[model samples]
Target: MFLLWFLACGLVDAEGEPRIEAHRCAAGYYPENSATGCAKALEAGFGTLEFDLVLTRDDVAVIHHDPFVNPEICTLADGTRLGEEEADRVYFKDITAAEARAGYLCGGIEVEDFPTQALVDEPIMTWAELLDMIEGHPDVYLHIDIKWEGDLSRPPDTYARVVMEEFWARELPNDYYVSAEYPEPLQEVEKLDSSVVTSWSWPSFPDGESTTLVAIGHELQTTLGTEDLVQLANDAKVDELNIPWQVADRRRVEDAVASGLPIQLWTLNTAAGLEAFGKWPVEALITDYPAGDAP
Candidate 1:
């Protein structure tokens, strides 16, 4: 159906041009949040790549999905495998980024969880390491999901500044975008340098309410109505809105489009889901499989 609509709407040609963002640096192929994952996505013809950033004890940001090391996937530097119960206690906040990097082999473990992931010994990479991989490929777009877990190791502004400073130093023409569930860090980012593109990640609850907008590190704000969502985004100085595809219905898409704010849908995996969402007016679709259904 999307293929038919694609021709009718002229959305894309044989090249399939609806923007596809490789979520977690193509988590389907490599270890999630690794430099190799970033490289693989760029080589696979994905122009946009997304990864999660969590701060280490020394205020250095690194690429990792969960705030802690997972026992199922990672083995410590001395080959210590933490039990499920002990994993969460080993927080990245307790260790320096260098210590964190030296402490793990991120791939080839958890075979039952990600059987298809390629076997490689990858260090937990720094934000700088990942960014370095993208420098020569200016055509690529980087989307950062800045994770804030209420850790006071670094001030909120300091956290945002470190990340934004990397982008500012690049001076490349708008090749990056940052997103957070709340506005605190991004607000600080804007304060430091308004030139960087930032998006507020608005959440949708299961109770059928699509109006929950969180400004973490500040306050919890609710939208008066569905129609007001777009205007609220603009008023907040948000460049775009990132919503999970499961909760983004027709009205949400229409409302976003009406307000002139682009929507990037998250974690849509299957080809059918991709095709269905492609029919919408979304700016980007984020997924783990950029080169889908591959060996």
Candidate 2:
């Protein structure tokens, strides 16, 4: 009861609307990271759309989540499909943006986990196409998660430069953010355009641990100390801190707020989670169903 009151009467600013960022443009109802999904989110009155970005073989930026295509969310554009054995072998970095689009149809494969998701034949959107969609809606914000897998064989600076250059060429009208777990890409973004917002995202664990253990591990690590964590974000020239919801407890949120940086909690999907956190004063809620009413 107290927690609910605190969220309703304390956390939110009197003058500010609770900022809601649609995860993958409301992936609960539409295909994750699809153009049509984003359109639905915008039409539903969400002010922000959070999506993913991966560079194609030719260094063009395209909107997709996994470093490689997942057969569960996508399938081959050609008459022949990618066999299960070929799924992990094909890399987005090896295909041109057009080839990437011509190669697969997004939202076609039904995600068993997200049965509510409307399956539609939407093509994987290029960063350029996404920018074009949001061109007139200056109020709509974008959160671009740079999906980089550590292939130390390639320089981070080179990849960062490519991503940043793509943003520059488009000159998006709305305020957009670029973030990664590491500082290299953000550093490059800062160097290229300080005006554009940059963020640093960290998981509860190293990122591939079991889901059940992540919350416990995150609490143990971040709770032990926060000064170093706060300092690291500052050193990275990050404009904001993006932490998983599980670790953004009162103490951690307070610590981050004290550092003078606004924080965003990521990937919350339930109404219970939303209503619970809605009372806590944070920058925004990153959710799959942003339109759902929460207490």
Candidate 3:
């Protein structure tokens, strides 16, 4: 079933148009990672939805972009605002899924960068809840970005097992893939279930334009020839490469195509970006404004 769906995804690239994956559930139109945003994206005809995942204290997966609740966009359950320092102390790993849903509300304030985002108060969503919402939309593909930044308690292998267990239990019909900046989590996922598809997300550059990272280690990868980067991804056993648009030059994209591995670009929201990157023969373009007229 997934094989057929993946082939259909490739057909989009064959038509010279990269499939658009809604980043954070069309965050430019709705609140980032909110259930409302996800529903809106599906309503707006998005075939692919990308979201972040983090485990709660009880090892339940929840949809959230950050490890900690951000005071800038979230408020307490009683509608009380939280200070940045206070919000920082509330880590997802430290709270149970029930506590996360009942103790806080996100999307109360607009993200400064997304000027047109709708301001709607919403609770955090469990992985089960998200799956239920999208059950009717089986054609929709999911790009799950795992967030495990060096937490000793939740090692990469443990994280992969927990997430894969939840996924296997659901027996979802929709096609999906897992992605992470570091390859350990993806490698572990492959070890757990070789049938599952995994994407290797490249760390962002130091300009801070991207959310993932901007370390010296990534600088080396970006500086390397496209073949070398593709070889590295092959070594990691990732099925695809999720790259930042800033460094996805024409030559590099062409080289990746020659290597026969699909490349997906991220966070492209502008008309110019869509116009420019759309010319590349990549597999998908992830954007915050999938419902907008930009693409």
Among all windows of 10 consecutive residues in model 1, the one with the lowest summed lDDT is 214-223
lDDT of 2: 0.74
Candidate 2 wrongly placed segments (more than 4 Å): 1-17, 78-87, 152-155, 204-215, 226-228, 293-295
Give me candidate 3's TM-score against the actual structure: 0.86
Q: Which residue pairs in candidate 1 collide?
A: none
Ranking by TM-score: 3, 2, 1
Give the whole-model CA lDDT for all candidates, comma-separated. 0.73, 0.74, 0.80
What would the C-alpha RMSD of candidate 1 be, to one decimal place?
Answer: 6.0
lDDT for residue 56 in candidate 2, whole number 0-100:
76
TM-score of 1: 0.81
> Over all chains combined, what TM-score does candidate 2 have?
0.84
* Clash pairs detected, candidate 2: 7-279, 57-93
Q: Which residue window of length 10 is worst by lDDT in model 2?
A: 9-18
Ranking by lDDT: 3, 2, 1
Q: Supply every candidate's count of residue pairs whose N, Cα or C atoms clash at under 3 angstroms.
A: 0, 2, 0
The sequence of per-residue lDDT tens digits that candidate 1 reaches over residues 153-192 is 3566877987777756777663778987666777888887
Question: Model 2 over residues 249-283: C-alpha lDDT tens digits?
Answer: 76557666777777788878788887677665578
